[model samples]
Target: MRRTREEAEQTKESIFQAGIELLATKGIHETSMSDIARAAGVSRGAIYWHFENKEALLREIRGRLQSFYKSLVDAAHIDSAPLAESISRAVRKLFKKYRNDAAFRRLQDLNIKISVLYAGKDSFADDIIKTEEADIQLFCEAVEGSPATNSCSPLQMFMIMESLVGGLLIRQYIRQELLSDEDIDAAVAFMVKGFSGIEEKTKTIHQEQ
Candidate 1:
């Protein structure tokens, strides 16, 4: 029997949904293509037809997450905003996802955990790394156009900010802490303050020179 294109698309989506649930609950190492097939109620052959491997399925998940994160950054981007403001917006955007986007955040938490476990040896690890770096590059752009640009490198600033976000996310995952509105606000404040301190210190040094 020939399957319609729409049917195929639906099956693919089902497989992805199943894969994400399994990945979140079981972690990548425990979740397999067969597991996804069982959960999706599709045959193993169907899973293979849709995705070449577990990595391929995860790549799709990562792509969706990348698009979601990109939308947030695009919405928050402002030409005239201060770098700290831009960074705050981006961080706040992340916590918004934490509160609202469960699947993406699960993938995000798993990606961080797996990176440490795999240590750059896994091919799929690069997808997560690249996606995160590309997202943080938004803030790097903001730094480039900021008045404090001379104080620090935009790439360095981006790295610092991204690390702070990443660390907090990892902590949340490990501690199983729920990030409330107030918690998110405080986290954003800390991020803004950390970067602002750097900016101000650099400014004072420049003035002294």
Candidate 2:
């Protein structure tokens, strides 16, 4: 029997979800099409109909993750708020999502594996670099507009923010460290203070000019 379009789409989504879960748990090298099919409760034929191979499935997963990040950035009400407020809100939203979304957390773990394995010839690597560049630009703009960041150039503030977020995530994920509420609050406070210092320096530079 021929499946309806909606049914086809649902099946495709199921396959992708199953692939992601398996990739996260088993690592890409260990996961097979049959494994995915079994987890998804679909035929191996169905998996092939949806994806050419494991690499294709990984590409689709990367594309979906990129789309998700773009949607989050697009929906942020940054333009309506003070620069500091907008940035703070965005950062908070990001960490909150990291804490809550199992899929996101899993994807991140998968990404780390991909980065290590395909270090040289990976399309996902290029995509990650592009994504980071875009994020840095947005952060720079926000920092420049905020009263709390009057001392530093947007680029400097961007790097600082990136370091803080990256460090936190690494510690939380790789070290199996528990991230308590107090930890997040302290981290944010430290970031804000650092930004404020940069702003002061920027003001001094402007005054000297």
Candidate 3:
């Protein structure tokens, strides 16, 4: 029997999700198309029909994550808003997604594992490194473009923000606890205040020099 287009797409999505879960838990080198097929309850032939290879599937997953970050970048670049407000809103939204969105949580888990497992290795390592560097540049540029006073370098601000946000997510991922809204907000506020203080200190140094 010929499968309907909707059915084929549904199967493809199932296979894709299964691949993510296995990759997140087993690491990329340990996962196989057969594993994904078994987890998805589909045949190897079905997996091949939807994806050419594991690398192709990983690229699709990376692309979805990139698109989500791009939207956050856009949100953080609002011209009329204060830089701190814009950044806080974007960060809060991301933390909220981590707490509430199961699929997003899985994607992020897969991404973190991939970077840790592949760094300083081969092609996949280089690709993930370049992608991360580019993402950092995007956030830096957004910060630089903001109207609010920014005495610190954009890269400096971005590094601090990334460290805090990444640490929070990593802890959440490892501990299996969806952090409370109040906890998330308090952490975010602390980061913003720290960033603001750094900017002010930098400005004072510039004035003295």
Candidate 4:
């Protein structure tokens, strides 16, 4: 008997979910189509019918995360707020989602695992790096256009922001304790202020040269 469209989509979603869990917990190299089929309670044939291979399935997962990150960047640019405030708001929103959304958290965990385990050896890793560089460039352009003082270069500002958020996320992942919105705001403020003297320091050094 042939399955209806709805049934096929449902089966695909189940397989996708099971694949995420297994690949995340078991590591991508160790997980197989047969394992995903067993976890999804579907036959290997069904898994193959939906995804051509494990890499195809991983591409779909990566697409979802890319969309999620893109939305955050788009929303941050939707208004004329100061760069620091906009970044702070986006960071707080991200932490809130990580704390409240199980699927989002799982996807993040899976992405980190993939990057760690396959960074130099896989096409997926190259794609991940390209996506991240594109995202950072978007923010760098925003910094250049903003009215804020360029105490540091746009690229430097972006690297600082990325480091701050990435470090906090790793800390939260290990501690399993999300920081409060107020705390995040304070941290962002400090980061913004931390570079306020860079322009003056550079001027002093240039004068001495």
Candidate 5:
């Protein structure tokens, strides 16, 4: 018998959830489609119905995470605020999500695992950075929208900002140091004040010119 659209959607969500849990506990290479099927309480055929292979399934998982991050970016939107403040709010918003949301944290853990553990692999490793493409765009827009746009290329600015976030996350994940409340404040300061100096320097040069 054919499944209802809602049933198909639920099965897909179940497969995603099960895949995330297994990827975290078992690692990507170790987990199989059958394992995901068993964990999701679906048959192997059901798994294949949604994904052609494990790589496709992994990409789908990353897609969901990308959307989640996009939502965070969207929620942090402060149109009336200055670009730096708006972007800072977005970053802080994400940090809060990381601290408070178990699923968000696990998704991050899974992200690090895919990017780091499978760096040499084919599709898995590719998906890691591919998922970040939208965020890079988000940061680009934020930086270009700022008064500091004259100081550097938006891509350069995006890389610098994302690096700060990525470095902190990797270090914290490795060292098992949960971010202190102070760290969140420091993040905002770093993002905001970091560019303040750049903007000032650019203004001086432009005035001199």
Candidate 6:
């Protein structure tokens, strides 16, 4: 009997989730279609039916992860809120999401490995760079729309915010530090202060210019 469309989608999701788990634990180089099938509790043929190969599955996983992060960022809608409030909220949500998502945390580890291996030679690096640029642009636009718009150029503030967030993530991942809710709040407050200070400096510079 042929499976229903919903069943097919369910199976696909199962396979994808299983693949993510295996990829996180075993690394992409160590994982095979057979391993994915076994982890997914599906047939090897079923894995093929859903994805052409391991690389295809990896690409799909990357796309799904990217889409998930993009949606989270979009949901913050920082452009409509006051500058300080928006930045605070956005950082809080980001840390909350990172803390809650085991899969995402694992993915970040895997991505770091991939980055080190590919570094300057991989097309994937270009893709990641473009994605980061797009994220920064969205953040800058939101900052520009805030009440603090006159305080700083959107681009300058975004660069500062991005650097702080990136640094925090690296430290968290590398040191395996315990990140509590209070820590997140404090970090966000610090970031907000840094953003405000930079903006004020930029405004002063512009006035002088």
Task: Name the candidate that leads on lDDT.
Answer: 3
* Local accuracy of candidate 1 as per-residue lDDT tens digits, 40-89: 99999999999999877766765765654465356446657656776588
* lDDT of candidate 6 over 105-180, digit per residue (tens): 7766666556565577667667666666776666555455543556656776665666776677777888987479
Candidate with more favorable, higher TM-score: 4 or 5: 5
lDDT, candidate 5, 1-209, per-residue tens? 99899999999989989998998889899999999999999999999999878888767656766754465356335568665676677677767777777898888777777666657887666666777777767756655555578878878766676787778777777887768779989988888888778878888998999
Question: What is the lDDT, from 0 to 100, of the residue 174 in candidate 2?
Answer: 87
TM-score of each: 0.80, 0.76, 0.78, 0.75, 0.85, 0.75
Per-residue lDDT tens digits for candidate 4, residues 1-209, read 99899999999999999999999789899999999999999988899999989988877777777754464466447677545556666666777787778889888777666656666776777777676777767766655644343356677776676688777777776777777777677776776566444545655766788
lDDT of each: 0.75, 0.70, 0.78, 0.74, 0.76, 0.71
TM-score of 1: 0.80
Global lDDT of model 1: 0.75
- Model 6 scores a TM of 0.75
- Residues 1-209, candidate 2, lDDT per residue (tens digit)? 99999999999999988998888878799999999999999998999999988977876755655543443244333567545445555566667677887788777667666767777865757766765677556545544555455555667665666677767877778876656777777777776566556657667778899
Candidate 6 CA-lDDT value? 0.71
Over the stretch 1-209, how does candidate 3's per-residue lDDT look in tens digits? Answer: 99999999999999998998888778788999999999999998999999989887886777677754565467667879666767788888888988898989999877677657556668876676566677777776777744233566777776677788888889988898888989988988897787667666766777888
- Please estimate how well model 3 matches the true structure, expressed as its whole-model Cα lDDT: 0.78
Answer with 1 or 6, whichever has the higher TM-score.
Answer: 1
Top model number, TM-score: 5
